[model samples]
Target: MTDLNARHAIVTGGGSGIGLAIARSLAGAGADVTITGRTLSRLEEAAAGDPRLHPLAMDVTDESSVADGIAGAVAARGPMAICVANAGVAEGRNLLKTDLTFWRHIMATNLDGAFLTIRESLRSMAALDYGRVIAVSSIAGVRGLKGAPAYSASKHGVIGLIRALSEDFLGKPVTFNAICPAYVDTDIVTRNVNAIRDRAGVTDEEALQMMVSQNRHKRLIDASEVGAAALWLCDPASGSVNGQTIEIAGGQAA
Candidate 1:
């Protein structure tokens, strides 16, 4: 049996991309997973006929939605032993051209949403005293991504939250950590590629290369790589690995 046998987990944004991959990994490891997103159809699609993967429609940006959605998941699957706050928006805009609405939108989904998810999940996790809180930050969180001031700042804020929570929960059974990934081949990246192509008047290949070149490996990362990192963070022996940012940018020096 896997370490996650009979464990209950909640993965936000699990309708697609990295979130879905992580949910699959957790379920494969014997977890009873609740996959959440804003679209019920997408969430149901991700469930993919898997009995262990339950679909929950949730908008992380809405406090009431987060609260009720998590409550319902816990009521059905029991207390969430693992919470992966992976719901976020990835967009780039120069500081000069960015507006308050743009900045707040990113923060609402990336930073504030993560804070809400972690906060609500902890209400149940604290009772069990055993939990793993993983936030899907970006390499931008560590350093900074060019042309994306708002995104970088929001990601940095996520890492800050994780660090603070880790300190607050010192020596406790719960651990808080953030995974900083570079350009992974997800739908988000595809959208960014299109945006870049349109903005820069560059070819599709060139736009993709622009992102791929940022990684040390000069290749797009896989969602499973991030999922595996998350899995490692939840390992029984990883109790002492807290408050750290694990960068999966193909060995990028961050």
Candidate 2:
């Protein structure tokens, strides 16, 4: 573990799943981290697991909320030096069935939320001239998912944002990157399995298999896999890596 002592970090949607895993990894590396989510109770519960994890209720979709929430975290901890825009929503919907509200809902939480988090974190980190911005995008962001047009589009936007930000910070200490994981073993997969069972009238086992088959290796990725990847980007050795999308899809996302 690279000693992150005295470093300040932020992980959005850190209440559970991949976000929580990343938070824990950063804390274990010695960075003071604030985990934020829409629900205060969940955030508190997650924070209780580690002294380095502090709970902050912040709705990433809302601009003011993200600004104020990050500001509050800075006030309590310190200016964020590492930011993981890991909060996102994923759902499968046909283009025909994806209404405006559904499309906006997906974009707001995934793309817009990442934008806000990174924007605010930049204000703080740029002041110090050092930082790492990691966005938890998806393989869907890199390629198209069959049934989730809206979700895919939103994730694609996240990659675009990161790429653009990296260019904006060229020759600077800050680095912007995206992690595109195909199917991480997280609560999102469980929820997706239930949805698949309900919508397609498939057996629970069949529903589970459908997602497993999405990855070329025929296995779900562990949350820790993604966490370790995020932690590595924050390592000082990764300073030269910028404007890149790292894929963790077991194999090529096809």
Candidate 2 colliding pairs, count: 0
Question: Which lDDT values do the candidates have, in the order given?
Answer: 0.93, 0.93
Model 1: per-residue Cα lDDT over 4-75, one tens digit each: 987899999998999998988888888999998989998998898888899999999999999999999889
Query: In model 2, which range of ten residues has the least summed lDDT?
Result: 121-130
Quickly count the clashes in candidate 1. Answer: 0
TM-score of each: 0.98, 0.98
> Per-residue lDDT of 64-135 in model 2, one digit per residue for the tens?
999999998898888899999999999989999889999999999999999999999888898776799999
Q: Model 1 off-target regions past 4 Å?
A: none
Model 2: lDDT equals 0.93
lDDT score, candidate 1, position 23: 89
